[model samples]
Every structure is written in C-alpha cells, then in structure tokens.
Target chain A: MSAAMTQASSQAMSHAATDKRCDVSVKDVEISFGRHVVLEKLSLDIAQSEFIVLLGPSGCGKSTLLNAISGLLDVNAGQIWIGGRNVTWEEPKDRGIAMVFQSYALYPRMSVRENMSFGLRVAGMPANEIQKRVADAATMLKITELLDRKPSQLSGGQRQRVAIGRALVRDAGVYLFDEPLSNLDAQLRAELRVEIKRLHQRLRATMIYVTHDQIEALTLADRIAVMKDRVIQQLDTPQKIYREPVNRFVASFVGSPAMNFMPGRVERGATGATFSLGDLSIPIQGYPFKSPGLTGAAVLGIRPEHVLSGAEAGPNAFNAQVEMAEPMGADTLVWCRTPSGASFSVRVDSGPSIAPGDTLPVSFPVGTLSLFEEGPDGRRL
Target chain B: MLAIRPRLASRLAAWVALSPALAVLVVVYIGCTTWTIWISMTASRMLPSSNFVGLRQYEALFANERWTVSVSNLVIFGTMFMIASLALGFLLAVAIDQRVRAENLLRSIFLYPFSMSFVVTGLVWQWVLNPTFGIERIGKNLGFADFKFDWIVRQDMVIYCLVFAAVWHAAGLVMAIMLAGLRGIDEDIWKAARVDGLPTWRVYVSIVVPMMGASFATASVLMATSVVRLYDLSVAMTNGGPGIASEVPAKFVMDHLFERQNIGLATAAATSMLITVAAVVGPFLYWQSRRRAAAGAH
Candidate 1:
C-alpha cells in the first residue's frame, strides 16, 4: 500500500511540476501587534503544487505566517504574490486561496452540502454549478452520505472532513491548512494525516500546512520549514531536515524520543580531532565538520537509532549500563548510562529482550554523529 | 450498600439546600394562585365570600371595554417590543464586536438604561416625549416649526410610544445577552466566512443569528414576561390617558383589585393572564426539551 501511494504521489508531483503559475512568494513580511513582535522580515517562496509544511512550537509564528499568506492577516510591510499577482491588499477570497482551520470552522447550522457550496453561492455561481461542485467535493472527501447532515451531527473527524470539503469546492490555486488535524484523537489524527497526504498527491495543489507535529510535517511535506522565534531555522526536504538540522532547535524538534546530547569537548591533537567525555574518547575523523580544525567545548548529538548495540557494536565499542527499558511493540527503547556517566537511549529491536541493570556494549557510529558548539545557540560544528 | 448511603446522603443534602426555594414556590406562588382562582369563581366583592358564581367574573371581564383594550394593547406591545428590541440589540452587539475602541465604555453606556427601574425609565421618557417641552418643542426650537412629536398623547399612537420607551429600556439587556452569545462563537468561523467571501451582513443574518438561538430565546422570554407584567411604565408615563388607549392587563387587574374595589373581576383577569402565559410557555418549554432530547440522541 505504501509503495503504491509513493508511486502515485511521485507521478502526481511530476505532473504538477508543469504548472508554474501557482507559485507563491511572501516577500519580507513583518507582522506585529502593538509592541509585541510575532514575525519579522519573514520571507519564503513556494513552487507550484508544492506541499510545504511550516513546523514549529506554539507561538512560533507558523500559523501567523500561514494566515499572512492566506490574506486573512495584513502584513505590516511586504508583498504576497500568488500566480505572479500581488495579493497583499486583496481580500482572502480574491487571493485565490482556501484555508482549513484547526477548529474545522464548519458552519454548525449548515448542512455538509451547504457548507461546501456556500462560497460558490456567495460568488453568485449558478444553482446547478453549486450543486455539482458540492457533490464532487463530498464524493472526493467520501462524505457523500453525510452531505445532508449538520456539523453538530458529525464527529470531530467528520467535521474536519467537511471543512476540507468546503475548501476543496473552492478549487483555488493555493490551499492553506492551520493545524487542521490537531483537534482529533491520536487514531483519527493518524488516519486523517494519511488521507491528507493522499489528497495532496491527488490534487497536487499548492498547499501550505502549519503543524507542531513533526510526524505530520515529515510525512506530508515535500519540504519542511522549521521555525523558531519568528525565524526560519531550516528549510529542506524531510530527510535532510532529520539528517542535517541547521541548529540545535531544529535538530531537537524534528525527531521523536529526541536526539541525546552529551556535554563534551572536541580537542585538536596530533592524531586528528577527538571528542572526549569524562575519560572516554572517540575519534571523529569521518564526521562532517562545517568548520574544520575548530575544537573545544562542543556537544555530541546522536539519535537513538544511530547507536548500535551487542554484536552490531563492531570494534571500539563502549559498555553502557542499562537503566530502564520501554517496549514499544516493534522495538524497545532502552535508557542507559555510558561509561562516562552520560545518559542516553537506544532503539533496539524487540528480539533482543534487553532489561534494566544489564551491561550492553554499544558503539556510536561516527558518520552519523552531529557535533555542535556548546553554548546557548548550538550551531553545528 | 456504602455507595447507596453516600448517594442518599447527597440527595438529602440537595433537598435541604432547596428547601427554602421550595417553600416559597409552594406557599407564596402556588398558594396564592390557588386562592386567586377560587376567589374568581365566587361572589367576592371586597373580601372572600363563599357564594359560588361560576364564570360570571370572567364574562364581566371579557365584556369590559377597558379590559378588552388592555388585552389588544398587550398583544401589540408584546409583538412590537419583542421584534424591535431583539433586532436593535443584535445590531448593537454586532457593531460593538467589530474590534472598536472604548468597547467596554460603549457596552456600559448601552446597558445603563436596563439598570434603572421601569418606572424611572418611563418617567424619564415621559419628559422626553412631552409635546410642549420635549422632542417636539426641541425640534421646533431648532427651527423645524412643523414638527409634531406628540405620539405619547395621541390615543391611537400612545401604545407605540410606550413600546418605544420600553424597547429603549430593555434592548440593552438583550444586547448584553446577545453579546455574550456572539463572544462565545469561535473566531475561526468568522475567518472561514471571510475566506468564503460572505458579506458581513450575510454572515450575521444567515450564520451568526441562526447560531444564537439560545440567546434569542432568552431575550424573548425576558421581554415576554415584562410584556405580561407591564403596569408601572404605563402608569408613570401616561396613566391610561386619552380614553384608556394605553391600559395594559396588569394595570387593569391592579385598578380592579384595589382602586375599583372589584376583587372578583380582578382575580378573573389575573387568572386569564395565568392561563394565557401557560398557553404560550407550555409549548415553548416542550419544544425546547424535545430539541434537547433530539440533540442528545445524535
């Protein structure tokens, strides 16, 4: 199923590559309320039919940026362009965009059909066209049976689907989603996340999504813009963002169970640079360094899956005393203390049956390690 | 058994807490209503007399032209007040919700009239509507010599003047209730409407107003009760002037009960009012409960 979906998405993406008119450009946008600054000098360019996710914590200005692009918010300074037309002064509807909000925002008194077709009706579209568009959107959302029902009669997932249907009926060049699935339960969130990915692949519309969920960002975005403190920390493909976060904030935020950090020092010696924690030293000869020959007061960061244990430890392995084990169905997350007294976790396959207090030989693969300068802003080394 | 004990103890506590309210409902409300209904069926002049006269007081009350006029005036006042107040109040709420400056001050200013008693409000409006010294004279002084603002004294238009004053006094309370409802609505809905290209008035009329069914119901109920009990406003403003043009049901019952020394007719009018109120409220309460049950079922 996954392979087929990816194949379909790739085909749709290539097909969508031809439509360059829908590209969106946000130029030097600054948004502020009174004395508090929410976003300043933010700029981004989205290609036609691209699925771009703005990933950030709450109050990080991700949703604010989305709102600015949608023309629902007025930027204090800057121009927003959709399809080469400056839409900064235009109303949201005239900007050729549709948005799905976190709260669903479905009109409670309107039926699913009415909710989806309201925009067309307001635009003075003919009755037959409105009916056809409503029908098409309802079918696309698989809510044809629920078209006559009110939003109050639907479940959270169903209401969100109706909201998406409302946006779909617009047939606008750009689509904006502001944490649309955050109100759903875990199971429903996962379900809708996959559905949204599929819908993006099928529609191939220029979609900008805002989410705090890294999993959603990773799974849905063609490119993820990780933001912090009203600034874009990193913007890259999901793989690149996961493998090469530009700074500590992006690095710590983009992964689940999070990357482990050890306060260590990179010393430049006659035998090349080596990272030393307490008495344990590891050569970082193969690691990619942004600034080579630089040393001292650095932090070594490694994901749980990057640490190998037992037979896979290879040569030059260190013994780690196991602290606890949490079995998560397919794998076990074992918390352990290194010989240097640094605490970290390892993701071992369920077959290993690791337990607390067990001493395991684990090796850090130097190629996958991320070394950062130790300070408040932990820029990559 | 332990669970039952705590449950019973909590139930007893609830009953104990409700005892005073229950006593008032029984002794003051139900007892007086029962005695009034009984007295309406008897030949009671100034005091209670057990000479049974079935439906005679009601016949007399219906035949009385003043009581008839009072009933019709109430219907007009009730209909006009309910619509005008709700419309004006809802508009005021929508206007205030536009992120305006001095919103709290504006809200308090709008709501100030409701804080005053109806008699005070009526007296204030009486001076304002008085032809010689009020708006008519002010208009004439302002150089419009043909201005004729005399609705308060004109017999055919006097009830409307009462309606105007009452709406002015009560629309603020309705505004407060409707404003609360407007605030309770999710802000995202407005954004969605804007994205849908809905005009502001269209959104209020089609979406926002429909969503505030509970607010409308609450405001209407309060206004309806005031309509049924409208006596002080008329007394203070016009005192059934211009040949009983502004007489209301409550004032009729009051005059018959004390000033006219006709307790039987007064009780009869009061009983008719009780029945009329029940007739309107019964179906409304039933429909509300039914809607609630239907909502819960889904």
Candidate 2:
C-alpha cells in the first residue's frame, strides 16, 4: 500500500509542469449544438511559443475549435490542457488565453487605456500595476498616443491595434485569434498581417489563430492545422502541407485557386501500377497504393503550378483544350479541360497568348501527384 | 426666378409643416409656462393680479416647514428611486437578453407593471405594505407575530416606502429601454471579449455597459422627468397621512392649488420649484447639449 501510494503521488507530481510546458493540448474534443455536431474527436498538441493557425473552409469547425481552446464553448468529451493545467471546464481567464476578435470588440465608451486595463482591474490588481501594464502594452503596440481616445474615435486599424493591446496587457500564456483582420479593408489587412507576424516574433507567445483564408494561415503559422467536416485533415509545417497533403481536403485547401482533382484509373503496367485517363498512361509506384489496387476509380491531385507547359513533357502529358486565360499581373492562370473531360488549371510565367478553345499539351509531373482512394463520401478519392 | 435654391424649397416646406406644431408648442407649452411664472409674481389668489408682493410669498414659502419637509422628501425619494430603478432595470434587461426560455412570459411580467396607472400602483402597494392588513399581517398569521414592517407610517423611514413602489413602477420602462440597448449590441462584442480572455460578467460590465450610453441616457431622462413630476403615487399610497410623512413637492403644490384653495401659496411654491429646477437643470442641460454637439462634430 505504501509503494502504491508513493507511485500515485509521483504520478500526480509529474503532471504538474510550470509555464514552459505545451501551451495547448486538446484530447478527443467533441462539440455539438443539441444534435448537430460541429467538432468531433479532435485532438491537437501545441508546443510553447509556436504559432498555430486553424485553416479550413466555412462550417469546418476551425472557429469552434478555437472557442473550445478559449473556453467560450465547452467540449462534450475531452480534456483541454493549457500550460500543463487542465482547463477544459475552467473560465476563459483561468485558462490563461487571450483572444483578438475579427470585429475588434473595443469598448466604445472607454479610452484605449481603460479598455486595456479592464481585465486586470477586475482581477483586483493595484491601480498602479494596471496602469503600468496598460502603458507597456500601448507602447509595444505603438498606440501610446491614442490611449486617451475611445474606440469610436479611432480608425479601424487603430481600433484593431487597441484590441490586440487589450489582450497583450493580460500577458497570458496563450493567445487565441478569431480572424482578427477579417473586418479590415484589403490594404489594411495586408499591413496588419505583417504587424501581427512581428508582434508574435517579439513576444514569443503561444498562439492559435483561426481563419478561412489560406494565405493568412500559410504566412502566419509555424504549423498549420487543416480542418474539414469536424476533423483535422492534416497538421504540418506550411511548406510540407503545400507539398504533401494526406488527403484531398488538405491538398485542395492549402493552396490558392485550389488543387485540381482529375478522375483517373489505375491499370497494370509492365513496370508497376500506372494511372490511365483516355489513352495517356502515367507511371506511379509504391506506398500510396501497394496492396489496395486502385482499379475501379481514383483521383489525381495536381496543383496549378505543377501542370508544366513546355516542349518536353514529364510523365503524364496529354492534350488539353484551354477554356479560359486569367492574367493576374505576375503570373497567368490557364484553365484547361482534359481529354477525359476533367477541368484543371495551369500556371505560367508569361504564356503564349492562350485564349479559349486553344489546344495545348499539358503535363502533370507524376512525382507531385497526390492520390486519394475511392470512398462513398468522395473524400477517399 | 425662384427666391431660394432647390434644396431651400424643401427646407421651406419642412418649416411650413413644422410651423403649426411649433406654434402650438410655443403658445400652449412655453406660453402657459411663462404665464404661470408671471402669475406667481403677483398676489393672485383666483386670477393674475397686478399687485406686486415683492418677495412676501417667497418669505412665506421659506417659513412653511411642511414645504421644506416636502422638498427634502422629494430629493430623498428622487435619488433613491432613480438609482434603484435604473439598477434593477439594467439587471433585468441583462438577464432577459441572455435569450433564456420563457422570454415572452418574463417580458410580459415585467412590462405589465408599466401598464398600470399611478392610482392603481399606489393603491396596490398600500394594500401590500399596510402593517396590520398586508404582508406583515400575513407573516404574523404565518407564525411570525413579531413582524414589524410599518415603514409607511414612520416619519423617518416613509421615503423608503415611496422609493420601493416608485422603483417598482418605473423600472419596467427602464428595463425596456435597456433591453433595446442590449439587443442593439453587436454580437461580435461577446465573441471578441470571450477571445480576449474575459468572463461573461466582465464583458457585460466593461464592454456591454459602456457601449450602451445612448440607451442609458434615454432611460435616465425618462426616469428623471418622472422624478420631477411624481404626484399620484404619493397621493394614493399614504395620502400624506400619519401626519404629513410621505408628502412630495408635486403633492404639496397640488394640494395647495386644488384642495386648500390657497393659490397664492401654491403659485409661490410653483415659482420656487421652477427657480430650483432652472438653477440645477438649466446649467446641466446646457453643458450636456454642448458636449453632445462637440462629440457629434467631425
């Protein structure tokens, strides 16, 4: 009995780690509104000072997951750990997480200083300490001169900075952001995105940001968690996700203009298994399809940039009819239809003035092909 | 060959439409107010008289201890009632705004009080607060025979009873105003404050209340006006009974004007109240409007 008690006490002591542990950990989290589930069995482990972005399509539970971390929405099943403390049922403040909102919810009647000091004041901190934190956060945000102005008196960018400053004054272990730049104009969004990146580097605070915009996720995150249909499709470095996506959703989600999924068939070739669409045969091998011989139907995931247009072709070159040419200043997007009636896009630096109905031979580099198995929901392919 | 610009014609038509309403407002409301002030200056009992009293009525008003007591009672009642009603109203509004079930039932329960006339309100409160016949008696029968709740009769504590019923009647309207304010709050604020690591109550206190300035102002003005014009609740509840304990300023002016047939003293009291209100309210309103104009500019 004494040995068992010793082991139990040691186990309990091991669970306790100071501020430098994993910043956020969600285990088997499920959130449902009545009967409709938004997030199901989602688990993620976030290391300290890592900037993680939740990127997904609308209704994909990215925002819901963020809320779960913030303790705004309770998970039906699962425990949330923040800085080595279980905070699944804790209040948002107790969880040591601060959030910046999409709409910049600044207090219209309060000056920037008061808005920043409100949380600390409510915690019954000394007035002088609250003022010091407010001043430091204001200076860090470059909003010291605007401290006396109310939110209504500030511009959208200024108000957003103050909102961020309000969160910074708390000096929590984690920061949660819910599409904080969605309210700004396009120009301001771009500018503030840079500012946020700089702020993250300076603070080295753990952050979990949610956004539907893939570019923001790609640019801002040290690690990106791509979500779809209440599940995390893939979580990896942004470049890895761009290069190697585990499934169709991750493949399509991580890139702009989306990756194209062309219907193809696997046929037995002399060397190995080869992909066939119409008369074109592209050789592919190994781990993606070894035993579960993809015969009936499969999808070939190819990005617009990978569809090379040149004199010499790669593995899967076929005749494609150009449907539309969209010139986007730096690069040209050539929308084409394949011989097998699949539509896709090709990116070129400066294409030979391709127009509608223009016939061109496009090649898909087989090494870059991401394959999905055929399933009933269509995600398997 | 038009006399003014095209936009000016629209302004002219607007002014033309407003002139009748403006005329009535100026003649009926402002004119009667000015006439009342003029009559109070004279030694008029039944009608306006030319005889100058030269501060005689003012001297008499100062000497009347009942009038003095009435003024003090009004101040006490007004402050307590306004603050209490506002707090209770805001709390009710916040609670209801949570979108709890049985919303319409709770709303009707709160709003039904505003549908009552002051006569009915005072009578109902009197019935409930009467020590021998009301809640105290009920409690006594329920086995607490030592119950002593005779605030309506006590001279020192009578104003509290007045505050209780007055707050009960006016808080509903304040709730409605605050509810509208609470509803107009952008849902994004709740989500943002949640993200900012604030508890629900902090969000309401720091974010929600501050953003609800216009609603609070509207509710406050409505309540304050009601405070100055408080009359019937006093008359029905206590009837200035138990030896003039619950008398308010409006009641004193009203009793002297109608029941006592002492128009000189009544008009004199009215004039004093007018001067007092102007002394306090005139500067306050000027400063408020000026600040509002400054805020609105640019």
Candidate 3:
C-alpha cells in the first residue's frame, strides 16, 4: 500500500474511536405527510457538542429530519431523547433547543434586541436576566450596534446574524440551523460560514445544521449525515465521507466536479483483482475491498484530483489525448479521452501549458479508486 | 441613437395615454369642486343665482336641528362601525388562517356581503330588523312575551341599528383584506413563535397584528368613505326614520337639495362635509407618506 493511503485510513480510524456519548438520539423515527412518507424508520445519534451537518440534495428529507429532532415535526412512530430525557411529544420550546431558519425569520417590526429577547420574555425569565443574555448574544455575534434597528433596516447578513443571536440567547442544549446561509451572496455566505464555525467552537454546543452545499458540510461538520431518498446513505466524519463513501449516491454527491466512474469488470487472478475497461487493464492490488475476493462486473470511480499527471505517476500509467483544458486560476482541468475511448478529466497545477490535441500520460492509483458493483444498488465493493 | 429614439418615442406615447385621465381629473373633479364652492357662497335656491350670501347659509345650516342630529349621528355611527368591523374582520381572518378545511368556501361566505350594493344590504337588513316581524316576533312566537329588539324604531337607539347593518356589510371586505395580509406573512414566523413558546393569542396580538398595519389602513379608509357617503343605506332602510332619528349628513344634504328645495343650504352642508373629510384625511395621508419615506431612507 502507498504511504499516503495508509495515512488517510489511519486518520479516519482515529476519528471513529474518539467518543461515544450520545447527546441527541433519534430512534426508529417514521414521518409522513398525507400519503407521502418523508422519513421511514430513520435513526441517528449525535454526540454532545458536535457539529453534525445533514447534507443532501433538495427533497432528500435532511431538513425534515432536523425538524423532527427540533420537535417542530411529530414522528409517526419513534422516540427522540435529548440529554437522557425522552422528548418525543414535547413542545419545541420545551425540547431544550433553538433554531435558525433560511429566511432569517426575524420579527420585522421588532428591534434586534427585542428579537433576541422575545423567547426569554415568553419563558418568563426576569427582565434583567433577559437583558444580560441579549447583550451577551449580541456581542458574540458582533451585532451590538444593530440592536436598536429593525430587521427591515438591517442588511441581509446583519439580519442573519441577529437570527443566529436569537438562537444563541436561548442558551439551549442544541441549536438547529436550516440552510441559513443559502439566501446570501457568495462572498457573504463564505464570511458567515467562517463566523458560524467560530461560534460553534466558542459555544461548544450540540448543533445540527442542514444544507445542500457540500462545501458547508465539509468545512463546518464534525460529522456529516449524507441522505438521499428519505434515508441517510452514510454518516461519518467529513474526511471519511469524502474518502470512503458507502454507495454510489454519496460518492457522487459530496465532491466538487464529482468522482468519475468508468464501467469495467473485475477479473480475479492468482495475485489480486484487476479491473478491465474496453481493452485497458488496470491493476487493483492494494485496494481495500469491503468483501474479500471481490470479482464480478464492477465500476471504477476516480476523482479528478487523484488522476496524477507528469512525473507524479507511479504505476498503471497510460497515454490520453487532451480534448480540452480549462484554466481555473489556481489549477487547470484537462478533459481527455483514453486510448480505449473512455472520457475523463484530470485536475493539474496551472503551471502546465498543456492544450487540446496534446497527449499526456496519467495514472489512476488503485489505492485511491472506489470500486462499486455494477447494478441498481451500486454498493461499494 | 436608435435606442435613444425608441426610448423617447415610448415616453411620448406614455404621455399621450395619460392625457385623457389628466383631462378628466381637471374638468370633472377640480372643476366640479370649484363650482360647488362657488354655489355655496351664493344665495341659490331651486335655481342658480348670482347673489352672494357667504356665511349666512352656514349659520342657518348649523342652527338646523335635523342637521345637528345628522352630524352627531354620523360621529357615533362612523366610530362604532369602523371599530366593530375591524375587530370582527381581523378575528375572522385569524380564524380562517388556521388551515381550516373548506377554507375557500368559508372565505367566500364571509366576503359574500361585500358583493351586494349598500341599497340591497340595507333592504335585506331592514326586513331582518323589523321588530314586529323579525327577532322580536320570533322570540314572542317562541313564548317569550317581553322580548325586545326594536332598536330600529327607538329614537335614541335608531342610529345603532344603522351601525349594525353597516358593519355587517363592510366587515366581509375587511376580512378579505386582512386575510391577504395574513397570508403574506412568512410561514417561518409562526414556527419561530411556536418555538418561543408564545401563546397563539399573544402571537396574533403582539406580532401578527402589528405587521398588518397596511391591511388595517386599507379597511379603515374604505369604511371612512362609506361613512361620509352614508345616504343610500339610510334611504333604503328607514328613509331618515321616524322623526328623523336616523338622519346622516348625506341624507341631510339630499333632503335639503331635492325634497325641501333648499339648494343654498344643501351646498353649504356639502362644502362642510368636504372640509371635515379633508381635515381628518389630509394629516393622516401626510403622516403615512413621511413614514414610508423614512423606511425607504433606511
């Protein structure tokens, strides 16, 4: 095995063995709307003070699961426990949680201070205590100067900060965020993304955020629950999720430019399994197989960055004609067709001046390739 | 150059399209208003005359007992109808917004009264409020001999009967406006309030109602205009009533101008009504515009 592959797997193994204290547990939850089942017997366990992001495409039931955890939705059959208490039927306020919404959801007529203090007042907290909590949250979110302004008077990012402040003032055990940064522009979104990470670090509170943005999931989550078709496909640390997705759906969903899949058949030899595509044979010597002696019709998945070029190639090298090269400031994406006529892309440093019609040698490391059974299920082999 | 010419041509076409409306405003609205003021200053009765009378007609108008009762009746009726309709409409809107089944049907039923003309509304209510044959008669027939619902006939309480009918006719329209406002609210606000542990009533009172200022303004302004022009209902229901107990300003003007043949007094009363409306509405409009400007500035 290559040294880099061994190091990556060892790191993922260490992340899995850190802690097991479950602060929030959703067990056998079933949710449906009329005739449509949103979540069917779904279960998840979130560690205390861990930022767990529910990542999926739209309509993948990630937000619905978050709502169920927040007690905003009632499950047909399941139990939700928070801090050792079963809160299956508890009111959202009594569930020891606070939430931020995609639209900010600030009271338009209320000042920022009032927005942050409203829940405390509703809970019958003393006025002075409410004032202190509001002050602390406002200062934490850096919205002290905006406390007197109505939400309509504040900029979009400022309004979102106030929304986060509203949740922070609740001082609850868990904080829920539902696509809170989706409404902002790219620059503001990146700025607030960093601030949310910083806030999570400072508060050390259990937070479950939902978004379709994989960048947000990768940067903000201690662990991500990647969902599709009303069930979580994989739940693991972000590195593990990216490096070793459990199924084809998760393999394609969590990466930029997506992992490329080449249809092939796994051939069993005396030494190891080799994947064959058209007329080209690629060795799969050190590939970790979930099942031993994995031999059958299979597909090989390679990330664009993993397709090394020039002298970085170690073995299994082949020549391909470049069809196009797109320079993207820091890097260039070269779209090429293999000698056997299979198309794929290679992400290389921008230092290379390679153009279309040029031939370049690229290597696909067997240690980094994701092999899946060629079928409707497409489970990783 | 081509783009500039097309833009100028569109601008000229827009002006040409708006000219008819401008001419109508100048001739029909401003011209009629000026002519009425001029007639109010002159001593004209049954025919237009050139003799100037000035404030003499105003003096006579203030001294008239029926006119005094009409003005006071308007004050009571307007205040009661506006407040009651707004409260009832807002309540109906809130109830309907609770994801009720058959919502479209209920909304249509509530707003059905607004579709009828005031004359029809007044006539229909006149039968329902006829003490001898309405609730009083029904109660007596049901074996209660002392049942009394004769507000339409009572001298001191006749105006309240008018208020009840006006509220019924107008509250439905208010409900439709309030419903639209309520629907425009983000669904997330309700979820936030729920998470805040706010009682449903408190949420409506503190958060939802304050957000519906525009809807309330629209409903109140419509009610105010109806109050100022409260002639057809009085005419159809009670015809200024027994002993003119249900008299209103518009009825007074109509009676003086056509029935009593007192054009001079009628024009004076019309001019007074116009001034009263302007006095109340002008400052309100100015305040609203200023508030809008302040919000825009931020």
DockQ of each: 0.86, 0.46, 0.78
Candidate achieving higher lDDT, 1 or 3: 1
**Candidate 3 residue lDDT tens string, B1-298:** 9879999999999999999999999999999888888888889999878799878889999999999999999999999999999999999998899999999999999999989998998899889889989888999999989998998889998898899998898888899999999999998998888888888898888799989988999898899899999999999988888798999999999988898888889989999999999999899889989988987886
Give the distance in Å from residue A271's predicted Cα in candidate 3 to where it truly belongs: 6.1
TM-score, one value per model: 0.95, 0.81, 0.94
DockQ: which is higher, 2 or 3?
3
Choose the strongest candidate by TM-score.
1
Q: Put down candidate 3 lDDT per residue, A1-381, tens digits, no spaces.
A: 234323433332213212223289999999999989999999999988899999999999999999898888999999999877899999998887889999999988888998998877877777866787778778878999999998988889999999999987766768899999999999999999999999887767788999999999999999999999998999999999988888888889988878888888888787677888888888888788988876878988889998988778766688889999989888998998888888999999999699899998898898778998786459888
Task: Indicate the worst ten consecutive residues by lDDT in candidate 1 chain B.
Answer: B43-52
lDDT of 2 by residue, A1-381 (tens): 334323433322212122335478999999999999998888999998899999988889999999899888888999999988999898887777788888887777778888898767766666766677677778878999998887878989999999999888766668889889888898888988998998888777888999988899999999999988888888999988888887776777779878888777877767887877766676766636544665657877888988877565544567789999899888899899877677889887764687899887888776676777664234432
Kindly indicate the candidate among 2 and 3 with the higher TM-score: 3
**Largest lDDT belongs to which candidate?**
1
Indicate the TM-score of model 3.
Answer: 0.94
Q: Once superposed on the true structure, which residue ranges of model 3 sit more than 4 Å away at CA?
A: A1-22, A375-377, B1-16
- Which prediction has more favorable TM-score, 1 or 2? 1
lDDT of 1 at A108: 91
Ranking by TM-score: 1, 3, 2
Candidate achieving the largest DockQ? 1
The CAPRI-style docking tier of model 3 reads medium
Give the local distance difference test score of model 1: 0.90
